[model samples]
Target: DTAVSQTPKYLVTQMGNDKSIKCEQNLGHDTMYWYKQDSKKFLKIMFSYNNKELIINETVPNRFSPKSPDKAHLNLHINSLELGDSAVYFCASSLRHTGELFFGEGSRLTVL
Candidate 1:
């Protein structure tokens, strides 16, 4: 049983399009997060939610939105995709603030 899973490990689309990535965790954790890893392998936190409550909202683009229906799931939606948006999106979860995070395999988004 996977602790966390994301759909469409690879996604390729042109600019101006919209796409959504789904993520789910079975660990029953109370916190979930979305992270973006650029081509340089720099990982940055995007959004974090705990028990369906938005806890951390980073200075991300308005075109990117994160939705958490429950503590175990968080989905990402992007509008008007751009070339700069091409990166690997990772979903993560942690039991507590000081706990080590468990990450998904990541979804690669390629915007042409």
Candidate 2:
């Protein structure tokens, strides 16, 4: 069984469209994170939620939002998507504030 899973593994949409990627973790971890891998394959942390609380918010745009309805779920919503948003978005979870992270396969978003 996958420890972390995300929906819509492949998404292709036009620019300015709004999209959401749902993520869930069965590891019972308290901390979840959203990372963006750009076209260059450089990974950057977008957001982090610990026990359903926002703990880390990186220098991401306001158009990107991370919603955690519970400790085991973290969803990412992007508004007015741009070409720059075309990349792989990964959902990850950790036991606590740190340590090994179990990551989903990644949701590849393509904004044309």
Candidate 3:
């Protein structure tokens, strides 16, 4: 079974549009996180949830929100998407705060 998965490997849209990316993990992990990889390829943690509880929010804009209904899924929703939001979003899962993570291939968002 796939450890983690994200939908729409590529997304292209114009500015001001809203978009959401779904993420799921079947590894029975308790923590899931959303990370953004910018044009420079620098990975930054956006949010993390453990057992459906928000554990971390790394100063991300209000335009970006993450929702986790359970231990195995975490989804990201972006409102009023802008060109600056163009980047690769990766969904990952780990057993706890400091553990090896399993990442999805990535969902590329292109806002023009």
- Which pairs clash in model 3? none
- Comparing candidate 1 with candidate 2, which one achieves the higher lDDT? 2
**Alpha carbon lDDT of residue 78, candidate 3?**
99
lDDT of 3 by residue, 1-112 (tens): 7669999899999999999999999998999999999999999999999999999999999999899988888999999999999999999999895679999999999999
> What CA RMSD would candidate 3 show?
0.8
Give the whole-model CA lDDT for all candidates, comma-separated: 0.93, 0.95, 0.95
Residue-level lDDT of model 1, residues 1-112, one tens digit each, is 9589998899999999999999999987889999999999999999999999999999999999889877888999999999999999999998866578999999999999
Report the C-alpha displacement of residue 92, candidate 3, in angstroms: 0.3
Model 1 residue pairs with clashes? none
Q: Could you tell me every candidate's TM-score relative to the true structure? A: 0.96, 0.97, 0.97
For residues 1-112, could you state the per-residue lDDT of candidate 2 as single tens digits? 8589999899999999999999999998999999999989999999999999999999999999999999999999999999989999999999884679999999999999
